[model samples]
Target: MRDSFDPSASEIETTTAEEGKTRKRPRPGERRLQILQVLAEMLQNPKGERVTTAALAAKIQVSEAALYRHFASKAQMFEGLISFIEQTVFGLINQINQKEESGLAQARGILQMLLFFAEKNPGMTRVLLGDALLQEDDRLQERITQVLDRVETSLKQALRIAQTQGGTWANVSQDEVSIRAAMLMSYVLGRWHRFARSGFKKLPTEASDISLRILLSE
Candidate 1:
């Protein structure tokens, strides 16, 4: 049950012999990871400018052609980052669901997990908020939207479960569940937006203890 994703873990190294001298090189598929890591790092820039393939290639000390060899286009690189965000986030959500029997506790765990993840991965926060997807492929934003919808669905399920368990929400209608779920989702998105817009100085988890208590209170 890992709590966060480590971008540095994606790095790989290998040795290659070039004319009798050994040099370090990235193994197959390692360059792709490196590219994503660098892109994420660049997105941490507060300027919020659209990242160009040329800029990405320069950051990694590779020609644009080399990048294309790994990723067909800039969109593909962003897709890679999105894939990482999805896998990490949903994986944790699944863990929270499996370990917690109380729906309210599960909801609290999920919300806290999201904030902690964003606090740790500032660049991924931009991706989750669609800030990094600006001016890029339309499908990228669509994918992010889908991810958010699923998160809201998860929250709804947790709230519904709580209601069924005869707690504060026991008499609540499904519409109420939906509304609460939407509110929770909006809160997370607002925190992420502020964290990114503030140059990552404002952590998503800042004051989360009191906030979560209020949000999850009966």
Candidate 2:
């Protein structure tokens, strides 16, 4: 522990010397959230580089061992970010259900939000789109794929909504809706790839409105 900000990790341990009760460690959820928060902060690096465990520990003001106490592996710490992505995007999808009257608009709005979110979170885009998760454990990219699938699913649902409300439901089933959703998702993924490859100096939303006009247009 450092002299000034070296907060004791022992206080939250399982077997305290005095208590000896083996009371369970305080909430794992909170610690997990902190880990994810630190991971997000690490992603904000402008260089678009991979974040290391040592660097992450330094950012959180905790030792790498402390980070391990909460997460078994670096991959696990990334899973926490994956979980946040799922929760956040889906939560917003649920909210879109309440706010938007037309499914087409909901689909459009959701994609817009995803693009905007990625713009704000450069590091997260690397992870979400597999730009950052690549070359690590294979499973990490799979999890990010799941994140994309979830987004595609949400968009498909919105398309289904549009069919019913926007008079675009012309004999479309969920499968057809899913096809269109997947295409839209692929477009966004390509944009993300270009932006990341361009050192993040290239904005993904450049010419976005015209593109969305063509995509969502009849």
**Alpha-carbon deviation at 165 in model 2, angstroms:** 3.2
Q: State, as a TM-score between 0 and 1, how close model 1 is to the true structure.
A: 0.92
RMSD of each: 2.2, 7.7
Write model 2 residue lDDT over 99-122, tens digit each, in one string: 888877788888777777677667
lDDT of 1 by residue, 1-218 (tens): 55444567665554556766454777777788888889988888887887899999999989999999999888999999888888888999999999999999999999999999888888888889998898899999999999999999999999989998986779888888899999999999999989988888988989998998898777
Candidate 1, residue 102: CA error in Å? Answer: 0.3
Q: State in Å the error of residue 175, model 1.
A: 0.5
Q: What is the TM-score of each predicted model, taking all chains together?
A: 0.92, 0.77
What's the residue-level lDDT of 78 in candidate 2? 83
* Alpha-carbon lDDT, every model: 0.87, 0.75
